[model samples]
Target: MLVRLAVIAAALLASTGTAFAADAKRLGRYGEWESLTYTEGNAKVCYIATTAAKVTGGEKGKNSTFLIVTHRPGSKSNDEVSINATYTFKKDSSVELQVGALKHSLFTKGERAWAADPKTDKAIIATLQRGKEAILHASPAKGSDVAATFPLSGFSDALASADKACNIKR
Candidate 1:
């Protein structure tokens, strides 16, 4: 099941016509975090994925909820965060990521939310590096709002694994 889900997640990030293998290499596992690496054409793709530890106030969808921090060296996209709400988000609404004393916003699209730009990505990654936990809040289009919490115990290690997998520094 994880293999299948990894393929789907990779496909979601692939450019048009790009192909990804169904199985992704397990770079390492750190508590709730899992570092995975795969290939899309000639580019190396790496990401850390984790299931939400808690979810509140929304009906569930068929797909499981997850959070990912991806690195795509070919596109210079590193430490890019994306969350799957598992439910549609209200139009024009945003998801909030609270990490330690910092609160960052992610723009929504369908059931997925992402950092607005490279600056926001960098900031969020920086916070995740030192924060103990992160909470993702989502407002569904037609249902109740949901808040999902992710532990950060192994985030730094997972992130380092991703960087190594993608041959990225810092």
Candidate 2:
């Protein structure tokens, strides 16, 4: 777990648009997931993150992909889901997140994708917590289709840690 967290921290440090990741403090690691907290302009942000367990197609091994669920108490935002892909997404495209029999679409912007609304975010989080894995299907701006799989082994624990840190109720 330490090695994996190290690798994830390295990726986070090297990535762009991570908000205040430089000041993020580790909460804990559960399975393949990790929880952290950071302050963004005086607002505390608690989140859980996990890298793609497997990526296939479209420049597969060359991109960095991860899934994140964040909470912001100041804004009353909870269970905000975001998927980050190293490459820019196709213009006006939507990414598909599938977990077990549940499927949802997320609007794309640059390298990130998100649920259409807070309700959708909650739905996605619930699905993720109950499922074992999630598969994201996306189309990049300059490449073929890609599918990234994320294991949900520690998702529940990670989210719990984030929620506790943010003082969010369920």
Candidate 3:
């Protein structure tokens, strides 16, 4: 009876471990990122630091555009993140990112995309919701890739800045 009990306990531990691993994976998907803030003309801008990746097949990759908006007094500026590279997502779940002289394939799971950069030795990924927000997941892009994630708040700040600069009251 003791042997049988031990077996059951071991199985339970294994299952629990798998569950924990899955949950940990989600944690890497979305979060906050530290980026540079600058002023362009009358607009306050923010751009996340990034590197260029590669793309192929004459397909143009997607560029990182402003993603969020917040309008309040005193805080009036546009924020944007540098995509580093451009990527194109096909209907077949294949994605590609192009940066400088390099191009690489992107891995997509559901609404998320990931890629590893050989040059920078970091993993570059993004989680995007249609018509909602895009969070860039940047890592070392090389050996021991550690993701430095960035959330959507920066994008929203940029939008607010633009709106205020343009005097669009709504």
Q: Please give, for residues 88-139, the per-residue lDDT of candidate 3 as tens digits.
A: 2233343443332334454543223434333222322122211132333322
lDDT of 2 by residue, 1-170 (tens): 76666656655555545646667889999998999998878899898999998887666455668898989999988888998777788999999999998999999987789999999999999999999999999998876888999999999999999999999986
Which consecutive 10 residues in model 2 have the weakest lDDT in total?
A: 10-19
- The clash count for each model shown is 0, 0, 26
- Arranged by lDDT, best first: 2, 1, 3
Clashes of 2: 0
TM-scores for candidates 1 onward, in order: 0.85, 0.92, 0.23
Tell me, by TM-score, which candidate is best.
2
Which clashing pairs does model 2 show?
none
Query: Which of the two, 1 or 3, has more lDDT?
Result: 1
> Which whole-number lDDT from 0 to 100 does residue 155 have in model 3?
34
Candidate order (TM-score): 2, 1, 3
Q: Indicate which candidate wins on lDDT.
A: 2
The C-alpha stretches of model 3 lying farther than 4 A from their native spots are 1-80, 83-142, 166-170
